[model samples]
Target: MAETTLYDRGMATRRSVLGDAHVDNASAKMTEFDADFQQFITEGAWGSVWSRPGLTKRERSMITLALLAALGHDEEVAMHVRATANTGATPDDIKEALLHVAVYAGVPAANRAFKIAREELAKREGNGQ
Candidate 1:
């Protein structure tokens, strides 16, 4: 089978997972300062891996949270936790993922992730969005 076009597949998956506003903001921020990095994530992460059908977005989101938490990627972890609302990953799901992270990735990582998740979830809960 022929490979899917990167732009078509990547843009669709990006919008589906990240939401329009977040994607638009990221796009707007992609200037000469980080154009290459932006393109790399769009083509590699969104297009290549996320476009695969092996797992659902919910599954992917959970894995992402765990990996981000493990890697001490606080900013990305916060972003993914916020995205849980759009990705159908409930607060309970995040809790479970952090529990796993605590055991495997270390308690410190999970503890920090929990704080971030709690704050972000609260914001989302208040807005009812």
Candidate 2:
């Protein structure tokens, strides 16, 4: 059997969670400046962390949403919220996580995150996702 490399695992995991369109768009936009950065996130975030066995993708999705919301990473929060469909994380799960973000991170951050999440959810609902 062939040994799967970290980048390979990462690419697969990233594609599964983020979906092909997002990955392909990002790949199409890749350049010498960000090539290494992309590789690093694939290997580190997707391969090392997201591909781990202990947590369900659903659980990880919740945790990721909370962290991104707490950090006020608006775009990342939006992306991960969309990713919830693939991760099996429900709208309620996102609500709970953002509630934690409000308490632990601050109300302002959570408030903004809630708006983004609501918008993303609306888009997904409209698209029949």
Candidate 3:
């Protein structure tokens, strides 16, 4: 038997947190133009970083949300917000994280993040989740 590679481990962790459906959708849409970028994120972000033992997925989710929001990565913030379902992050936790973003990263960033987070949460609830 062969030992698992970072890509394999990353795919597993990504699927667990982002869900098979989302991961499948991403995989299906991968083109040559973005294939390398996709692999990099899987092996580097998901495999090496997210798969670490330092923090629970829930804590990582919160930190990810805040950082994404602070950086104005609106789409990623929304995606990670949806990922809260798998990460065990609550709505209140999201709110608190946004508050921290407001204080440290600025109210404008947090304000936009709050709107994005609300939309994502509403979309999830609307889907019968």
Candidate 4:
């Protein structure tokens, strides 16, 4: 059998975690200028780190949400919040993580994250997720 490449592994992991529609949209919109950047994240972030067995996907999802919130990445925070559907990170789990973020990363960041998460969660529920 042929050895799986990082790109292949990354694509699979990313699609599983983020969902096929989102991945497909991102892939379809890739521009020549950003192609290398996308490939790098696929290989490094999704393939190398996310594929690690040390942490469960749920654990990683919590960490990712906290980090994104702490960094004031509102959009990414929402995106990952949606990803929780596949990662098994519950809304309560996210709330707990954001509580920690409030202490370590500032209340404002955590507050905004909570709002974004709420919006996404509502949408997910509305869709019968």
Ranking by TM-score: 2, 4, 3, 1
Tens digits of lDDT, candidate 1, 39-111 = 8888899998988998989999999999999999999998998888778998999999999999999999999
Q: Cα lDDT of all candidates, in order?
A: 0.90, 0.97, 0.96, 0.97
Model 3 residue 26 distance off true place after TM-score fit, in angstroms: 0.8
lDDT of 3 by residue, 1-129 (tens): 998899999999999899999999999999999999999999999999999998999999999999999999999998999999999999999999999999999999999999999999999999988
- Going through the candidates in the order shown, the clash numbers are 0, 0, 0, 0
Among all windows of ten consecutive residues in candidate 3, which has the lowest summed lDDT?
A: 1-10
Q: How close is candidate 4 to the true structure, as a TM-score?
A: 0.98
TM-scores for all predictions: 0.93, 0.99, 0.96, 0.98
Q: Which stretches of candidate 2 lie over 4 Å from their true place?
A: none
lDDT of 4 by residue, 1-129 (tens): 998999999999999999999999999999999999999999999999999899999999999999999999999999999999999999999999999999999999999999999999999999998
Look at candidate 4 and tell me the lDDT of residue 4. Answer: 93
